[model samples]
Target chain A: MPAIQVTNLHKNFQTKRKAVGLRGSLRSLVRAEYGTVEAVRGLSFAMDPGELLGFIGPNGAGKSTTIKILTGILFPSSGQATVLGFVPWKQRRQLAYQIGTVFGQRPQLWYHLPAIDTFSLFGKIFELDDRETSKRIAFLAEAFDIADLLETPVRKLSLGQRMRCEVAASLLHKPRLLLLDEPSIGLDVVAKQRIRDAIREMASLEGVGVLLTSHDAGDLEALCKRVIIINHGQIVYQDKVSALKRTFLTSKLVEVRYARQVAPDFHIAGTETLKVAKERYGVKLRFEARQTPVEAVMARLSEVGSVVDITISDPPLEEVIAAIYEQAERSEAAIAK
Target chain B: MNEYHPTRTPAWILLIMRELKFLLAVWKTNIASAMEYRAAFIAQMLGMILNNAVYFIFWVIFFDRFRDVRGWELSDMFLVFGVAASAFGLAAFLFGNAFYLSEIIARGRLDYYLSLPRPILLHTVASRSISSGLGDFTYGILSYLASGYCTWDGFGRFLCGVVLACMAFTSFMIIVHSLTFWLGNAAGFAGLALNAMVTFALYPVTLFEGFSKLILFTIVPAALMGALPAEFVRAFSWGALGKLFLGALLLLGLAVLVFHRGLRRYESGSAIQVEV
Candidate 1:
């Protein structure tokens, strides 16, 4: 049986709404308006124990909502979900003992205290006795490379350092399943790599299942084996990371600022210029990696002029998901015909 | 079925005992966090004491002008102030989040507690410390001592009264803040309710009558937190103890009920961005 089994899970939220202007405000004061939002709709999936699964999506996608529901912090509006054979929302506390979580935007560490204080508190909370707690803390400190930084207050730590501590703290009890929501949201490249390396090593060493969520496709590639991409409360794509790369992750978005402008219609073969700034000094372009080589593009770029700055990145997850959705609809139509 | 180990089915009492240890650890962390700047912690605690002292001085001047109001003398005022201050102080000191729990709920900070293996209500409230409240707690004991009512019996009564009042205050705040589950962002509403309770609780319940008195006893619960407890302290009556116990029990029950009921609708702000 799967470690997690979610079938036809749905969650809806009701949010109060008021219009602009005094008249709208006054009307709302007398009679309020509310609208329903489907935060997660008919989401169904299952994961094997110790699997490295990435739940990736853009902001406002259902990734975080689904993770929250799986952790038992959220009750689905309808349908069912079981994590480790326990109904999550119904047996939240029980389920919590087996699962660790890190919500990127939320700091579980006490900001004004040293990271060690929180680690100790979590030890007591998780029911590990003093000696075992200390031993576990020391081991985690070494694994996450956070030993030297434990004595300093959390607030004084860099974002990267703090996040390392945060992740380490979550693992203190050796939960079987780790639910991480955007754990690398704001880390620099070096920091992100460090976190990804440590997480991968831990998951392998502990045989821990990771249902990791992120907005960046890079995280999925770096740490996850299988990938599920969701958007607007629904899954748009799901497959092995290799399959996803070939089908949906092939395109790249490049933004460049040149030292000088040469021509208005400056172009490169095998690449589509999505936007050229009005001043002609900056440009945005896209090219399929299978079709255009990066070295060729760079050679052409150098031929044009000295470059000031350049960034190569994945297209927004929203854009990728939208494309997948459109392709799915077209394929369905063709099959019907 | 999944292959994970069945969750440990600890006895209920065992669960409570573990959670209490968790609570103590959290409280210790809160104080340690507050004491990070030792001088600031001292300043805040002392400032609160001085502030409470100045507020009490007004009563001194009042008694100087006129001796008593309806068998309410300066000493009785001391007992009442002692109970109310200590109750509010204890609630503020230990469960500091109770004062602004609505903000935490509204902002979806409760996710931190909900994800943990502890009782949600206890862990959330005890997460922070209002160091200044330490000063209020000290002033309360001092005030009770100065009331000339600090006999062993009086001290026991004072302790009882303060514990019940503290529970009432904390429970009341929890119930108000839990309304945010249904009503969007009830922070301002909770703040207003807290102010009403605190304001009325500081005054003598005998000062009001009839419908207003009914409101105080049932709705705002200011009389229950203040005057009733003070009366119980002045002279122990089974009737007074029953009333105090009953009031605290009712409020605590309602608080747990309302908060857990509201937990069903906790958005965690994850749904906010998904709004239509």
Candidate 2:
């Protein structure tokens, strides 16, 4: 059976609305007004068992709201969702025993206690006896590389270290699926890379399904096979991650620093130089890989001057996703017109 | 992974045992967390004791000036205050989150409880310990002793009264706070309700007669929590005991039902909150 199945899920929030200033505040006190916010609108999707699916969206796009509904933390306004063959809202407790969750913005570790204390507590919460709990803790501590850090109070650990402990704690019960909402958020580059690598390793080793939601597209590129891009509380794009890259990640950027000073009029064909180093020894350029071959660009650069340093990469995923967002918005505008 | 779950046992008993185990572990962790700031814990606990002592002194002075008001003497004040303080303190210490549940709901902290595989209301209410509750409990016991009704039977009744009052008080707070699910951010209103309950609970039932007495019995139910319970402790009557028992059970049932009803309408906020 699929690890997750959501059909036409809808969530609406009733938000209090008050006008500005003293007069408005007094009027609201007498008869408060409220407005409706459709946070998630008719979202539908399914994930095969053990599949690493990326649910990517910008802020307020209903990614977290959908995840919350799937986890049974928030009830949907309408529609159906099942996790591990159990209806989420009705069978939340049963589903919880079979799934784990990590909310990056909400740390589950007790701030004043050591990570191990929370881990031990979780073992009990999941109904593990002392010996079994100890064995499981050792296993997870090793898996998440949190052995050395577990004894330190969560308040004392760095954000990255605390996050590792948080993830490890969630896995204490050996759940079949892991739902992570923005797991790499607010981490430094190295921390983000470490988290992604560890998550990938754990998923592969245990065959645990992962449904990850993030605004960071890098998280999708590094970890997931299939990707779903949501915008304005709706899915705008869904496909294999490779397909996303092939269709939109067509441009390449290169930065080269020459050992010797290059000529000022130095120009390469079919490539646009974005910036020149103040010392005149380095230049940054971009070219569509479709239009200009990377091998040709490399040969031309070598022909220009002796190369000291070079870096080649695709445009950051944010830029790529932004492009899709613009296309979706324009199409939506057309439909409205 | 599935072997850890024992499936052969009777379902309801197993469910109760598992939830109880989880509760114990959570309570243990809460105490350890409180001890992390030992100095602050001690200070808060002692400060509460001092605060309650000052309030008790006011009663002592009032009774000295006026010997008895409507057959309610200084001793009666002691027993009522003892029941009220001990009950409030016990509720605070055991279910500290009940006091600030509205704020937690408003700030989205309930997410932590909902994600776990345990009873949400029990876990959320019992996850924290109030350091000062110990002090209040101590003060209550001292007040009960000074009332000169410290017989073995009277003490048993006092203990029973405290338990019932704690149930009523905590469940009342839970019901008030659960309104946050319908009314957005009801923390301020909850605080007002708490103050009203505490104020009305400390006064003698004789002080208010017609409408005010009606308010105490039904609306705020302070009479049930303090005066009625105190009267039962002073001399146990089957009728009074049954009334207090039924009242506490009814309030507790209402609390659980209201909270679960509110849970359906819970609109979790995006306001960033750290689980401490």
Candidate 3:
């Protein structure tokens, strides 16, 4: 059975529509108005055990809402979701024991206490035996290289150190599933690498299924094999991370630095003319399995001039996500038309 | 799968104990940190002691101006003040985080408790330990001793009164904290309501006539924490004691029910990214 299965999940929030200005506020108090905002709408997905899945979307796209339902934090207005054979909302306590969550914005550690104390408290909370607790703490502390910072107060630690401890605190229970919402946010490059490595190791070695959501595409590239894209409270796409890049993104930018100036009107079949400069020029060419391979782009650039240096790159993940959004808008418009 | 699953994990009991343990751990750390600023700790403790002593002095002066205005002696008033002050102080120390509920909930800090395998209310209440309660506990003991109401039977009654007062006050704090689920910005309102309740509680129920006393004793239950308990201590009346116990039970039940019902409305904020 899959570790998580969500079907037709929906959530709506009743928000007070307060008008601006003192007069408007007073009028509202006398006769208030409220409107229902649909936060999550008919979302559905499933994740196999031991799979690391990336959940991505713009702000208010219901990414967090779906995660909350899966983690047993919020009940869906309609539909059903089960994590590890337990209905997440109805069997929240059981689900909690089987899942660990790390929210980037909030550290679960008590600020005034040392990281070690929070770990110990979690140990007690999860009902871990003394030996198991010590073993897990030692392993995580060493893996995250936070053993030295364990005795220091959480407030005194750097953001990176605190995040490391936060991740460790969540994992002390050795849950089979780990839910991370932007765990790499606000971390420097080295810290992000460390966290990515730890996540990969957890999924591969311990067989822990991980469902991660991040605005950083690098996080998805580093740790996830499967990606699910959400937008406007709906799931637009779900597939292998590689397949997402292969399908939505069709072209790659080829930059060639020539020994001399290349003709400005340089053109090649199966490739669009992009830009040309004195020493370097770029071309956007469709990535085809046969004709327009990397070698073909390279050979064509060489034909233009002596290729002193060359590099090929796909468009940024953000651009791809934006294109997906634009495509969704176009499709909706077509449906309306 | 193993077939040896118990009805429940006995987790609720363990969760409560863990909360108590966390409270103690936090209390120790805060005290150590507080002691680092010894002058401030001593000054604050002294200031609080004097502040509480002034209330006792005010009541003594009131009695001096008019002896027994409402069929109550000066000692009876002191008993009421002492019980309410001690109970309020105890609640403040134990559930001080209740004051931060608005910020915690708004910032989605409550997500940690919700994700944990325990009752959110118990975890929230036990998240912190307040040391200022020691001062209130001392003041209560001193008031009970110095008021010359320390007969063997009176001593027993006062202890019982303290227990019931603690129960009622804790229930009151729970109700106030649970308001965050609905009000979202309940800290200031809770503080105002709590201050008014505490102030009104430190007076004789007889000082107010009919409806007002009934309101205090029932709806707010401030009078039960103070006047009724004090009345029982001064004179052993079965009826007053029964009323105090009954009020404590009702308040506790109502507080728990309100908290659970409100929890269903709790749309936990996302901690993935806070706006500010």
lDDT of each: 0.88, 0.90, 0.77
TM-score of chain B of each: 0.91, 0.92, 0.81
Model 1 residue A54 CA deviation in Å: 0.7
Q: Residues A225-311, candidate 1, lDDT per residue (tens digit)?
A: 998877768777889987875677788998889998757787999899888886848988999888999888888877888999999
lDDT of 3 at B180: 80
lDDT of 2 by residue, A146-171 (tens): 89998998989988888888888888
Candidate 3 lDDT over A191-299, as tens digits, reads 8998888778767878999999887888888999999888878888889999988886677766667777666676776677667664344433344434477776677
| lDDT of candidate 3 over B136-226, digit per residue (tens) | 7668767877767778998889888878887887787678767888976677877776776787887667778889877897767788778
List model 1 lDDT by residue over B211-251, tens digit each.
99989988899987789999899889999999999999999
Best by DockQ: 2
Measured by TM-score, how close is model 1 to the native structure? 0.87
Candidate 1 lDDT score at position A165? 92
lDDT of candidate 1 at residue A296, scale 0 to 100 = 86
Which residue window of length 10 is worst by lDDT in model 2 chain B? B1-10
Write the number of the candidate with greater lDDT, choosing between 1 and 3: 1
TM-score per candidate, in order? 0.87, 0.94, 0.89
Cα lDDT for residue B153, candidate 2: 95
Model 3, runs deviating above 4 Å = A261-293, B1-43, B151-159, B235-238, B271-276
User: Which ranges of candidate 2 are over 4 A from the true structure?
Assistant: A20-27, A30-32, A258-267, A295-310, B1-15
